[model samples]
Target: MTDRHASAHWEGDGKTGKGTITTQSSVLDNNPYGFNTRFENEPGTNPEELIAAAHASCFTMALAFQLQEAGLKATALDTKSVVTLVKDGDGFKVTKSALTLTAKIPGIDQAKFDELTGNAKTGCPISKVLNAEITLQATLDQG
Candidate 1:
């Protein structure tokens, strides 16, 4: 397996200070975060947005892989992931993540698509890592 990494550096307090995060793989833009800005113009991308992106991409890829393994070809896969950060008892935490996916797969029935999607949700790396609940709504376009 290939290795990927990212780095973040922060100065001063959590709410007051700023931080710069860099994705070693060039997947994310460099941005800063602080009290004034949740995502800065000079620094890189925010963590929450990154997580959402990762989850979406991973889920899509997993579904495609599963379809291919099952001898089905996916013409298109569109996935949208929403990661919600809510107020917990003391601090903010990711409470839930919902994935909405539309897949156009050739020669695959609704039952097969549903099975593939279910497997993808469980197999996706990001989905497994997240502590919050992950829900997926998948639509398989036959035409």
Candidate 2:
């Protein structure tokens, strides 16, 4: 098994507090995040966006490998994930994550590509990890 690590530090109170997030990969070292970035229209990053990125990357990778295993070579796979954060009880909660995928593969049938896309949507690590509802819309390139 493999492990990945990320940390965030917060000071002051909840709304007015500030924090920095760092990851084991160092790709997001010292990245700033806070209530303003989460609720308000301020600069910086938020948890939902991060989750979206993770989901998109994971699903796309899964599709790539699945295509290879099915005797198909994918020229491109572009995916976008939209994470919805909704009010639950008192605070907030993630209710759903929707994935949209656009793919290009040489000599691939739409039906086969769609089957693989569905498999990837359900089989991706991030998708499996998320308890919220997951949905996928796939578009296969004909040109």
Candidate 3:
């Protein structure tokens, strides 16, 4: 099956501008930019949040695939990606992305898990796209 998704339009100057982000099922209305400073320093969806979401989702899926390839079933996979936008001389840039992951898998040893996680960190599409530093911390849950 082929699935497709889309988001609506955005315009304006960014810092003193305004726009809206719409998806297939949701619409972030009247998103503005000014004082709050994440998304244009006021109100709106910023790039960092988007990047975090993308990285988190991509990493989780990559880990799942890695586990399956290793003849193991992944019962649960949770990942959090923190994107840090820091001042780069004169402008702000995404300097790093820290990915924290917790997974539940039966019969997977620590060494194997660590190796798979490392491979997934490099194999994930988002991780491949960003030049920012990528760090991973993985916890394997045994029950």
Candidate 4:
């Protein structure tokens, strides 16, 4: 099994608090995120956006491998994940994650493309980890 790590440090209360996030790869070294950034749409990264990024990247990679496994060569894959956070009781919870994708794979049928896309969406590690509702919308470019 492999392990990855990310950490956050905060100062003060929720609304006015400020924090920095750090990742194992140091890609997000001292990256700022807080209540304002999350709820107020301030100029900083938010947890939901991070989740979206993870979902998008993970789903795309899984689809690539699935395509290869099916003897299909991938010309391109463009994916987007949108995460929705909503109020739950006194706090908040992520309610949904929607993934949209467009792919270019030569000599592939819609049924097969859809089957692989569904497999990737269901098989992606991030998708498995998420507790929210996950949905996928896919387009296969035929040429």
RMSD of each: 2.6, 0.8, 3.2, 0.9
TM-score top scorer: 2
Q: Mark the regions of model 1 whose C-alpha exceeds 4 Å error after superposition.
A: 35-44
Q: What is the lDDT of every predicted structure here? A: 0.83, 0.92, 0.82, 0.95
TM-score per candidate, chains pooled: 0.87, 0.97, 0.81, 0.96
Q: Model 4, range 17-95, lDDT digits (tens) per residue?
A: 8999999999999999998889888888999999999999999999999999999988999999999999899999999
**Tens digit of per-residue lDDT, candidate 1, span 28-99:** 446665645543434445667778999999999998889889998888999999888777888789877899
* Candidate 3 Cα outliers beyond 4 Å, as residue runs: 1-12, 23-44
Question: After aligning candidate 1 to the native by TM-score, how far in Å is the CA of 47 from where it should be?
Answer: 1.6
Candidate 3: global Cα-lDDT?
0.82
Q: Model 2: residues >4 Å from true position, as ranges?
A: none
Q: Residue 140 CA error for candidate 3 (Å)?
A: 0.8
Clashes of each: 5, 0, 6, 0
Across residues 23-135, which tens digit of lDDT does each residue of candidate 3 receive? 55555444443324474445466668778998999999998899889999888898999999998897889999999998999999999999999999999989999989999
RMSD of 4: 0.9
Residue-wise lDDT of candidate 2 within 1-143, one digit each (tens)? 99899999889898999998999999999888999999995988899999999999999999999999999888889999999999999899999999998888998888898899989999999999999999998998777
